[model samples]
Target: MKELYDTISLQFTLKDFHQQKPNLAFATAEKQQLIALLTYMRDVHRYTHLVFVTAVDWLEENRFQITYMLHNYDIKADFGIRVMLDRDKPVMESIHHLWEQGRVYQRELHEMFGIDFPGSPGVNEPMILEGWQGPPVMRRDFDTAKYSLETYDHRPRDTREPESHMKEKLYPED
Candidate 1:
């Protein structure tokens, strides 16, 4: 595992490495570096499984964090790489070439968080929502209450009905 870390570090900047557990994390500033790292893990280090991809909204910093989780079943270890992107123009390289499941996850992330993954297909297609407007749903900037009020026609329910047990009580008239 140290050898793997050394090799990857020599080629790119590894933000963090953990030896006590079976997890490693890498951070890169460039999309090309992320692609290269994933390719190396797949081809050289035998990390053939792409688990999932997700994002975190850092509203204070005005950036979104994208994370790709990869696993090597044979070696029984997992790795996660993260990249930060501007919220206004969030874009990153797609890892679909390395794993097919990445395509679906990337597409969902694109629609939910507005993070763009270059070279990914069907990113603009709707998955669960139709005619979505305003900021992306998953981003912190999107307000669920406000969206519901605007998009849906809600009405207050009446609570004037008498209680069912009141009719059977001794002081029912009161």
Candidate 2:
């Protein structure tokens, strides 16, 4: 695993090396460089399966983090490549060229987070949250409470029904 990391580090300019208990992570990279790295992993390293792809919103930094998780059964380890983009203009290259599953993830991320995957098919269509406005819900900056208050009409709880007296009065209701 170290060898793989070293090789990747030497080949491309990686921003950071992060290892979290069970997973290894790499920071953001330029689009072309990221494509090259994914290509190398798919063709040379034989990481044939793309497990998943998702994004995280860093409200403080006003950025979105997109992570692609790849796995090779033979290697028995997974590699996660993460890229950060500006919140206002979150765009990244579609890895669908290398892995077909990328298309599904790309669509999901597009609808769920509003991140744009240029060149990916059907990115403009909605998968969920029909007629949603304001900010993407997954983004950290989007306050759920505020959204609920704004989007939904508040209703006071109904207290019209009196408590059942059968149980308290025992046999009286018979």
Candidate 3:
């Protein structure tokens, strides 16, 4: 894997390269060169399987870190490519052309993180959250406590003391 990274470094501009294991590695790349980097990894390096696409909200940094996990069957290895996007305007190049499943992941990211993948199919359409009108819930700034207080109705229900309930259940005969 290190040897592969060494070769890729010569061709692509990558940084923060870390080898987690003999078969698992990750690297950070510029968002502008993501598509080209992904293509090179898939076509030349034989990372044919896209395991998943995920994002991290770096609230303090005011950026969103998108990670694309790819797997190579022949080498039994996994590679992660990370790209940082501006939190103010989270937009990324659509990878649906390379992998069909990318559309689904991008759609979810769009709904949850407010990331935009221009030209992705049905990206604007709601997937899980239908009839929902609120800020992107996955964002760090979205207050769950406040949203729940406003969105859901609080009802009083029967409650029990843990010690008494457990004692009754364990020593009912007594």
TM-score of each: 0.81, 0.81, 0.89
Candidate 3 wrong stretches, greater than 4 Å: 157-174
TM-score of model number 1:
0.81
Provide the overall lDDT of each model, using Cα atoms, as 2-decimal numbers: 0.79, 0.78, 0.94
Weakest lDDT window of 10 consecutive positions for candidate 1: 22-31
Cα lDDT of model 3 by residue, 1-174, tens digit: 788878888878889999999899999998889999999999999999999999999999999999999999997999999999999999899999999999999999999999999999999999999977999989999999998988899997989999999999999997
Measured by TM-score, the strongest candidate is: 3
Residue-wise C-alpha lDDT for candidate 2, range 1-174, written one tens digit per residue: 556778888888776666653445455565558889889888888877888998888878988888877787885778888877888888889988888778888888888788989898877777777776666777776689987988789997865433455454666655
lDDT of 1 by residue, 49-166 (tens): 8888889999999988887777888877877777778887888888787788888998899889988877898878877778876778998877899989988999988654366555
Query: Which of the predicted structures, 1 or 2, would earn the higher TM-score when compared with the native?
Result: 1
How large an RMSD does model 2 have?
Answer: 4.3
